[model samples]
Target: MKTSLRILIVGQNGQVSQALQRRLAGMGELIVLGSSQLDLAQPDLIRAPIEALRPNLIINAAAHTAVDQAEGEPQRAFAINATAPGILAQVAVDLGAALIHYSTDYVFDGRKPEPYTEDDTPNPLSVYGRSKLAGEDAIRQAGGQHLILRTSWVYSTEGRNFLLTMQRLLQEKPQLRVVADQVGAPTWASTIADSTALLIERWQRGQPGAWGTYHLTAQGETSWFGFAQAIGESLVRQHKPCAMLEAIPSSAYPTPAPRPLNSRLDCSRLLREWGVSQPDWRSALQQCLAGQA
Candidate 1:
């Protein structure tokens, strides 16, 4: 890490990657390579470009994140999420570059009543989660200076996510039924990018090993019904009304991939280590909605 670190951001088109680009603007010289240039499936392709750039820091935002789709396509998911990340970790190790990787809350089974911490033993219920967990293990096994940030309910102003999905359903139907039992935090992409930048700054400061798995999400928790209601309320306030959001059980709506009943993550380690306090989900949602407008 230098005064102006030479950085590489993988997955340019993804929401998280795009947000990272915006957050790192003017702070460092960042080179973003899309999947077209360096496909995660072809691990060998990464070496040439990475060795060429010789970046001081590498942030991997690329991932096969389609949850349900992963169930049928486990190999494809593992190829990009698990195997590719392992290859990247080795490359970073060879180059002695600090690696920043993103993970997910789905790694846990969501059976616990309390929020999950970084130290909790993972029991991923879906293929997507298993692949992500394997990726984390790969990074750690590579024995490199790395940061594995596990986040939940990622969304943005522009992207296919819960927020946009709800908005679309609201448009098509007069009433929408969302699962009210499952609990989790709705984290904005911009917030993750900001927090990432702060972590990078800390990494540059030469602090004692802040390189470990940490769960980063918005401050509080909310169910799908609660989240939808908040969004509907916002839409009503803007006079752009939508469908009536209704609460229902998980059994009411079934999907290809099984979802966790609880996705809440504990953020104590992140707060203590990075000296960062997350903004409330309501506030972050407002920022996102305002951006949408």
Candidate 2:
């Protein structure tokens, strides 16, 4: 008995949500629910919609992503990032639908010099990290068919991310101070969306099983300093005026929530299972910047 795959994409207005919606276009019957339509902070709000639609797949692009803010509002973060996803996962279990949830590399403490793998124990440093880790645990405990993908440094031209921040700052200021201690891949949401869709295609074809976790990030990594320089370089290539990018220690620019110094996520397991290699961070950045221009 072949069942037509009905897809549901949560978080309609977000950068990742919009990117996923664009990629999933014409793929299947996709139901997109915004926070207004379905408040993730209140998981019960999703029950009626899930019952009405009975989707074959649920892609959770919704999250409480304010890292520093989460430090002061742990309870709210837990409500949206942890508890909400748990309830959704339970619903998916009852409906026999596959749950695709995204996680963050912040699950690690950033103590390791090398890339962290899925097998590594999670030691979240901030409230946001803890909440996301809780969400992962909840879905795992639910015993539902799930694929958990942990990624980092996500950016899109439309969002309030590093790239946009740099673009705006470089326009106004003659010089900028960027933290160089933090290291991670600068992943574009478009690539992440496309890669996720490819994974879903395989899952529908009976390749993906009930449970798995994988890291999804760009091929290489760079410190925040290097990232800023690359952005400046891109601006120059685009014939836009460049700004002076200065690299400073993390200590110089402290935040309410401490960022991980090392965010290198090992994607070997991700590649081994998905059979897809991540695109280079520089190349991805080039396309993204060009699109913005």
Candidate 3:
């Protein structure tokens, strides 16, 4: 956040990373690396690039994101999600650079009836969740200048996400069965990137207290069914064909990794501390579709 800070983003092609590439332009000397340049799965490959770049800030947007796939590949998940971040945090500490890492709502087991806060104890339900939680713990334990922004239901037009998947499925099938019991705010990647830029600006103003875990997502919450219905409606408005969406329970759509029923995160802390408020999910979606058009 310094006037001429060099920012090294850890992921190159992921949804959030791509959005960050667009959003963080002209803000700093930005360098984005993917697995080819800095394979996070190989912990040995992480520190050297970071040390060579000696960036003023390191934004880690990469992770082992396959939720169900992680169930079969726990070791690979932990290696990238947990171990890599710890190493990166240590490197950041050595270089005296601040770190901004992204985490997920999956860290919570989804037992709370209401929205989960930062103060709530995390009880991850699956390998992916546990791995992400581990990365958060590693960053905290590193004791460096860092911000862990926990978000939920991330999607974008370009990446492999729910929005894209639904767009494809809706076109292919006459009807779709989406889980209704599970709930969360569908956060757009660009929203996260823009909000993050605001936080970076605040940090540039020398607000040391801005470095901490905060719930950063779109404003409103909805179930998967509601989300699908909204997406279909949006597609129709755009003159695209969309399937009939049906509400179903989580049990109906079985997967190797169990998803959280309540993925809603309380984002008051971010607003209270940094005055960063995101648009509602529906509005964000409309904007995303408009951008796509």
Candidate 4:
């Protein structure tokens, strides 16, 4: 790595952003920007802050992640998730820096019985998914050195995510109905950050893998009900009131945006190429919960 390497992260307070900040501390100089400092919805103003920093690596960890809420806010979603990524890619090219942006498995419609691969064609079912797919396209169109890491079911000890929500609701309620049909790995934010650090280390050693899209997530899969059961098990071990988790189909719980039935992502390519691997969803979740204790 260059001795004077400068890194600019385009988010703060987000699960992935906070993890990235902690993981990349000694790698280089970090300039993390929250929405107050750099609103992704304001595309026109993104370039100025980036250009001023002139970072060697720009990590975009921000996005309009409210899946159901995005249905009624297409313009804001597109502005942040689609337009902003394109702009970030453009600025990355101008600055001669590599960009690392996070994507999602929502790009796929989830009809495939097997896990979605990077080679699979994307057909988004919801506004959030469409906006994210557009962002991936915009980045590719910009033609810069970039990594569009498409991950699934991200959660952590902090922020608004599945893991935290389950921890709270499981103790508060006597019974909880979770979607059993919708299946995917519950990936911890720390795993993504640590893997990202490893990727950067490889690049610094001058042995980087192919620059493009790749899947990053935990090793195993589970449904929302399965995940909830696991969370309840943890609470039970802690002598807390554990909710009785009832498994129900997605049809039982309606939301504004449609969710994919299968969200499992094939991560073999990332492991094969980058030599990065992840713990099983169960183990990662345990470690994440342990951190809370």
Alpha carbon lDDT of each predicted model: 0.89, 0.88, 0.93, 0.94
lDDT of 3 by residue, 1-293 (tens): 45678999999999999999999999999999998999999998889988999998999999999999999999999999999999999999999999999999999999999999999999999999999999999999998899999999999998799898988899889999999999999999999999999988888887645578999999999998998888898879878888988899999999999999999999999999888899999999999989987
Candidate 4 per-residue C-alpha lDDT over 228-284 given as tens digits, one digit per residue, 9 for 90 to 100 = 889889999999998888899989999999999989999999989989999999999
Clashes of each: 0, 0, 0, 0
Sliding window of 10 residues with minimal summed lDDT for model 4? 1-10
Off by over 4 Å in 3: none
lDDT of 1 by residue, 1-293 (tens): 46668989989988899899999987689899998989998766778888889888889999999999999999989989999889888899999998999999999999999999998899999999999999999999997888899999998877688888887787778888899999999999999999998888877777634778998999999998999888888878878758987899999999888988999999889889878668999999998888878
Q: Write the per-residue lDDT of candidate 2 for residues 1-293, one digit (tens) a residue.
A: 12577899988877889899999887788899888888888866768878788998899999999999999899889989999888888989999998899999999999998999999999999999999999999989887788889999999988689888888798789989999999999899998998888888777677763367889999899998999899888888778887898889999998998888999999888678777668999999988877877
Greater-TM-score candidate between 3 and 4: 4
Judge candidate 3 at residue 170 and give its lDDT.
Answer: 93
How many clashes would you count in candidate 2? 0
Model 3 C-alpha lDDT versus the unseen true structure: 0.93
Please name the candidate that would achieve the greatest TM-score relative to the true structure.
Answer: 4
Q: Could you tell me the TM-score of candidate 2?
A: 0.97
Q: Clashes in model 2: which pairs?
A: none
| Candidate 1 residue spans exceeding 4 A from truth | none
Clashes of 4: 0
Listed in order, each prediction's TM-score against the native is 0.97, 0.97, 0.98, 0.99
